[model samples]
Target: MLNQFLDNISLPAATVTSATAEVQYWKEDLGGIGTVRAVNGVEVTTEAQGVISAIHFKSGQYVQKGDLLAEIFAEPEKAQLQVLDAELRLARRNYVRIKALLDRGVTTESDLDTARSTLDQVVANIEVQRARVDQRVIVAPFSGVLGIRQIDLGQNVSPGEAVVSLQQLDPIFVDFSLPEKNYATVKSGLPVILITDAFPGNSYRGKITAVDPQVDSASRNFLIQATLKNPKQHLRPGMFAQVSVQIDAQRKVLVIPRTALIFAPYGVAVFVLEPDENGDQMIAAKRFVKTGEERGDLVEITQGLLEGDIVASSGLLKLRNGESAIINNQNQPPENANPKPGNS
Candidate 1:
């Protein structure tokens, strides 16, 4: 009866042997939200106004350079070419006959010169007509995938009107911005990785291809572009991505398990262990600590903690200031602070 009463009155000894803090390497990485875009994207347009007689490319089809995409009505230009060709043949024969007569002393120099001038004039006119005819046929400027067509067959298209969109997909671009404070760390050739919701568990590796020299005065941030090889072409334009870059190779930091932290309305703190006044027992002391980056199961402690300090990793609420703590090493938590849900 006496032991049961004492146990009920006294504070139950909390399980204090489960958790620990260790000094480890904490790498500092910079990350920002970004957008994925095609390396070469353009809205294809027409230079000549006419009815779209035919569309040679299907929507989303891959086309090669110089492949015909569409054709505008060019009956007038074709007929003009035919007329010019006939005129050119006549002029060529006349020039040859005049030259032969001049050599034989049968034709005057002025007549031969007129014939030669007529031949050259016809040739120039033919070239101009051929150019007009070529403009009626729209061809792909580069190898790429064609987007949906804006104009349909038999539709009258105006000059400079967008007909379709083309985008190169073999390699893609990712555009992201970083704060001006990181300008010194970011540069062309720096490695980066991108994560997107479309592919949850995959990461695409890339390298910084360009960085804006001038920072935006309003935001104090500069833009950077990265090139990623998309052999599988899984990535597409306008996709939101999370960009990550390692700013420091090795960053020495003091880290503790996340379970050691005690969050409250006032501030964040932790329970640290120190020797009691009698030096015969250890007591839990509430220490207010300033934290920085958090990763997995570990968090960075920038202040109010030492590298080898002993802290209460769990049951922080039960352990308060001046509370006696029994340091039992049996069944301690894993040294790796990183959480592995798969292990559960």
Candidate 2:
């Protein structure tokens, strides 16, 4: 009879373990490798067919727009221009003489008109020859570094043939790709962090300048381009880069320790401690919480429990709804649970 009475009064030693839930911020990092390249690259070419009489600029030299890069032999075009100039002078003299004669009634109206037409033709020819001379001199179209010269001093080059390569190094571009799933999260003007093996311990910050509208069919990733201001010219073309994009900042949500939750076939649940009628404590039940995104060591509980709830973190797996629990004051419960009436 004594054993039976004790058994009826004794509760199972609650396998109690302490836990506290708090709010925390979480971040997810995604990684991708990319290649650095110039935002503008072009093959510098000659605009007219001629012999390269003089190379004005050396290879690997920085040049500004309209700076002479190479000079072609324009002697033939210049000689033609001289002949046209002489012809134009002669036409002007004839036109003047013809007008004087017409005023003096010595020449007909048709004679004066013919002389005027000849003068106009000569002027047009002179302009065409001048344009040909201008084409023989090759100039830089934009500010950039020139590549190796392809022709020697006396090498004959045809029109439209590549003379060298030029690239704008400052404000270089880094092209990378990200999964199509993150397409909506990434957009123009978002910040990016770039690192490369070539420049150890250095990181370049830039913004997304462009995002491809279409996702690649094979990889299902979209190409993204970032314009990094290389004011120091440290970033070089073709260098590999590791890129990170900062999507957005999210407010920290209420998080619980991962061990606090019990997963069941029906739903996920946690045990809440509440006072029973005898001033003892028992495990109250809160069931079926919806979970949000999880970060390291903690999970966001979206529903079913408030921030201040005293949850049985460790012994939840062995808990039952309305089961009796011993309030061992070994550890204080979370302060948020003990609400002041005004504060609550």
Number of the predicted model whose lDDT against the real structure is largest: 1
Q: Kindly give the stretch of ten consecutive residues in candidate 1 with the minimal lDDT sum.
A: 12-21
Clashes of each: 0, 0
Global local distance difference test of model 1:
0.86
TM-score of 2: 0.64
lDDT of each residue in 284-333, candidate 1, tens digit only: 88899999878777888889998778988766667757677877766555
Error of 2 at 93 (Å): 2.2
lDDT of 2 by residue, 222-336 (tens): 9999999999888888899999887676566777766677888888877777767886566656666878765545678888877777677665556667776654547533333
Error of 1 at 28 (Å): 4.3
